[model samples]
Target chain A: MRVPVLIRRPPEILSSEITDEGLFLNRRKFVQAAAAVGAAGVAGSLLRPKGVRAAEPGQDEDKLTPYEDVTSYNNFYEFGTGKGDPVKNAHTLRPRPWTIRVEGEVGKPTTFDIDDIWSRFPPEERVYRLRCVEAWSMVIPWFGFPLADLLTAVEPTSAARFVEFKTLHDTEQMPGQRRGVLPWPYIEGLRMDEAMHPLTILSLGVYGKVLPNQNGAPIRLVVPWKYGFKSIKSIVSIELTREQPRNTWMVQAPNEYGFYANVNPEVDHPRWSQKRERRLGELFKRATLPFNGYADQVASLYAGMDLTRHY
Target chain B: MNQVQWVRRVLKPAVFVAAAVPFGLLVKDIFGGTLGANPVEEITHRTGFWTLTMLTITLGVTPIRKVLRLNALIRLRRMLGVYAFFYAFLHFTMYALDRAVFSGLGLTVGAIVEDVAERPFVTVGFTAFVLLVPLAITSTKGWVKRLGGKRWQRLHRLVYVAAIGGVFHFLWLVKADIRRPVIFGAILTVLLGYRVGVWWVGKGRRQRAGHVVAAGASS
Candidate 1:
């Protein structure tokens, strides 16, 4: 102590070494301004939808296609045939106050209000790779519960072998319906087993927010293992049927679009090769995987069937 | 200035700038990152569109000259044809980059050869582009003089075939919406029809003149 200070006195920091309070505050303000600008720049490039965030980690290595690309570049013939037409014209769609009619070979035939389905299902997020038959693809973060859960809730009867989904048929709401684009009230279907697969979902939202109208607002089907067209949009009805439901594309061009529109690279479309697909936000075309890279999860379902024949 | 001088100095420059506008705008869009998510597709489409447009315009020049009695318009035809070739070249380049180079195929000619051989759409598009090569090379006045007017005119008629191939290439590629390609087909039809009508009228006039000369000689 007095003889020799037990604790050595710490060297004092010079006034120059200590940052001035005004300068520190100014630097923080500058940093905040820079950060705001950087965020704005990212938002501008992405044209991000409201309330949407980046997908949670470990979902995918491939970057999520920007929200703008997902919404704007749509193939919803219900809106129009042009790639950009959906975003331009889909505002006419009324997504709220919606109901989905569930019937046909079910124990409980009922129409579910959109909100009721939302609360009952309570959508969880799933990132999926969407492959289009047109040889383009996107990675999308879709929010939905399993389609099996909904099917179980409806209590499908033993006679149910297929699940048929239909879109709204109003010409006023969907202007493309005014023209004979693809036989209105676009229809899609899946085998009961395929529908029951956990990978299959009835999507309520995308990018962690309510879906934009162009991306099939309120509710749509998301079959991650199949082509984008197989996942029909804006469902007004879901029917469990005995026979397979003829889908819109198959009805329109039977030779071109098959009933089972699974993503098969070896089975090419009549008009073009399905071997390669241009991923959104990428310059080069990548080799398309069988079942769009979800073969591990879904290959067992089609173990014996010849995909080429089915495709 | 006289009309010809004005056309040479002012109108020609204006037309050149007008023709280049689409390409310039495309370049701006490319650099500005406004070509949307799939820039290669956008580039391919824009170039293809302009190629078809330029071909149509080139084909329309003769008819426009005859209809409006503006003989000076003939001067614009070669320039327009060259512009069509320009766009076609860009379109083909983009395809090669997409299918061969950027596709991680290592920029081999073999990859491009395979594309042209295997893909029917590419086959037709490549044919159309190949058809433009001789025409583009011999576009100058010197080559026109060397080939002689009749031979040069006969050789350049290949443009009609190229135009047809271009239309079919477009028609074959589309999935469902054929409206745009149909419109292009319609325009090409009207232009070719007009050319045939003019040829028929010229043949009739030549036959009549020959018969009159024979009658006078016999009398």
Candidate 2:
């Protein structure tokens, strides 16, 4: 039987120098295409650090079509508002040949290239239950290993109680960012322990297809247990810090969106009824499930706290 | 009306088809499988949009008639109001089905009653729609002749209430931006303002005429 669930695509980039494992190392096409993209990125970003253009040939390019199933979809207000606007507007993003600046409260301060970071963590295919803050959900098969692997590489000290991530902000490309409609350079965070959770994966791609421009090309954090907004898209920086980082939703409406946005049917959004959610594609009326039906795995994360209060 | 009446006669069918195209296309789409995986949201958004559009059109009739000096265009007002309710019915269908999980299969009445009681936005919107049903049923020339112009005018004033309700419905659903709702509010305001302004001006003219007649009789 074909399971009605989401499947993630493989990354366009893999290591050119194959590791001894040779597991995905045999996938050479992914590597060469990545190099071509990286070289272009270096030439472009070096040319104009604050520049944008119609998605260059290998800058996570795809032809515009009116109708197609969205491989990556989210309505996270912080990552530029609008449902379909992200990918259409994020064309000027310089994703490849990039660097993730990891700092603060960590034993080692390490800045790694995109290729090196991919090698540091072994990639895995995980089918996660995705719940949106709006209450609807989908099951996505994602590619990438545990975020815990990234934590281990950085070696966060005990004082490193939170992990905050940031997205690149260019007013030209991300017009929504230019507007004060939302705080720019969308920020998201997790308690150090939550960041280290096994289910938390730094997702690279979906549907066995490379990251679509709309879906946060290159890399994004996918925290399946929490609401979709908790998972930031198109990540640029990851820092281990003691202080909590400013999150986008909370800044917009503190009462409605809490820092810990878990998928609990009991806790409804302030403006609308949360008791029921309209599942995407269900037409009009479909009942919502609790914990997005992942209660078995993630229920332990919020065992003691009053979710209604935090929510 | 020599020229104006001819235009109205020509536009009658065109107007009817234009108003009906949405319901027809929606029904055809359901069968054609053009609606994506989430068809209910698709249908609801489409229906709701038309409901608002029709309401706006109904409100626009008087303004257009006044501005263009085409008083006969006012005849289109009733048909437009009826179409607003018709599209509203489709929007209600999609919302009901999408929220069916809240009410189990075949138990829609209870669910409907319960949801309206709990959700005030839906409650007000549905109430506005329910009131329009009677006016729609009584829109015939026979009913108008029986009720007389005064009574007919009074009964049909519910369109104002329905317009207010429609604006509120748009206001409640949208979360992020307030721009769309504000635009609808401004349009409704102007439509209502025009009616009051015209009535005040007409009333003053009649009072002045009565004073003139009384003075002339005394002389």
Candidate 3:
């Protein structure tokens, strides 16, 4: 019998969405043309930092805040204080041809170009919940690698107890720096354990695109579990110190901000509550999770210490 | 209608719409996807700013009438005060939504309660809104009649206290760049200064009148 022969199709290996690819490519061209015309003399290649494709099943599922919102609404006081000011002002910031000096307690004490660092640490997609002390949150799809990789490469000495980060201090570019706003060239620090945490990353982009100037272009730190300020932006230097370094916020307002700055719902800021946070896209405020919902990964680091007292 | 009657009939309503334009524009912006990236924060800030603006304008009415002898301006004071309360109410409700009440869904009463009780900025702002409630309720002619003029005046004096509270609430909440709040502080000071100037001038005139009458009676 030539009758009923079963015909089954092979399982599909890849599924790609059929959209207007031409339009996407055209828009990218437009962006390149605009960047080329800008006064900052930013080359197209330098304007967009190409990163390795992060593996699929990425945090794309974690309800991202709109790219517009992520770029427009920022708290980069280096640009200005207003929520919208950074987007308007940070356009002047030239992030290309950047170099970061890694000194203090490191054996190499190297000064590496931003491109070199990017090569060393291939990008990975990390969707992290960024909670600001101001009680607002955003789910950012950060393209970066574990800071541990960089720390490992640098080879921190045994005496290295803390890692201090410093941002670039160019008054002409960073207008807010001209004004004495919290002592310019903002500084942030982390303990050795916190620095090595896999969750801690050095971010170059967000939402699979090169980070916009206001979102801290080129490179910035992303300590997901800690308060957003702890993730200092537009990093220029990394120093390993023996003592706990003086963080900018803590030095400015010790009573309000602390060294650890771990996202603790229990430890309320002096002026505002930390119990709840308003996620950017949401209308209602949700209860803030301990360690920004990374408690499982980072809580172990703070085992014996009292977070409340430290905060 | 006569000029006086026409002004009474038409001008007040125009001012009412003018005062409410900010709120209407805000609502339209919210729906039109133009309230910027952080819509909740945009809403909160716009409403809060309008509330303060309305309160400042309401406080300026008496001074404007007395200094410029534009007695007709006094007619707009109650409307201004009511508008201030309307914006203040929106400001308060938006705060609940912006800060503690909403996430992606709707209201969370637990977070709201915790914020009202625990956060100093929220506590001060909530208190200021609560204090405005009585003044807003008594704004109507019926309520004013029920309270009686002297008692009503005494009750309404609480607006100054509420204004002070509002300024303090703003001062406490801002992280840095207190320039805007300080400017508002200056405006509030000037408004209070006018009231003090009037009171001092009135006190001097009354004391002089008393002295002249006493001297005339002795003579």
lDDT tens digits by residue: candidate 2, A1-311: 11212222334346343232233323323542544422111111111222332221121221111113345344644345545456556666666877778888888888877677676664655656566776555545456667888888878898999999998776664566656766778899998878887778887655444456566767889887788888888787899988988798798789788888877778877656565554443222234455665566667878898989977
Off by over 4 Å in 2: A1-73, A76-94, A178-180, A276-289, B101-108, B203-219
Q: Give the better candidate number (1 or 3) by DockQ.
A: 3
Q: Residue by residue across B23-42, what tens digits does model 3's lDDT show?
A: 88987887676776567778
Q: Candidate 1's error at B211, in angstroms?
A: 3.6
Candidate 1 colliding pairs, count: 0
Give the candidate number with the greatest lDDT.
1
By lDDT, the candidates rank as 1, 3, 2
What DockQ, on C-alphas, does every prediction get? 0.30, 0.11, 0.31
Q: Is candidate 1 or candidate 2 better by TM-score?
A: 1
Error of 2 at B49 (Å): 1.0
Task: Give all TM-scores, in the order shown.
Answer: 0.87, 0.80, 0.82
Worst 10-residue stretch by lDDT in candidate 2 chain A?
A38-47
Candidate 3: residue A42 lDDT (0-100): 15
For DockQ, the strongest prediction is 3
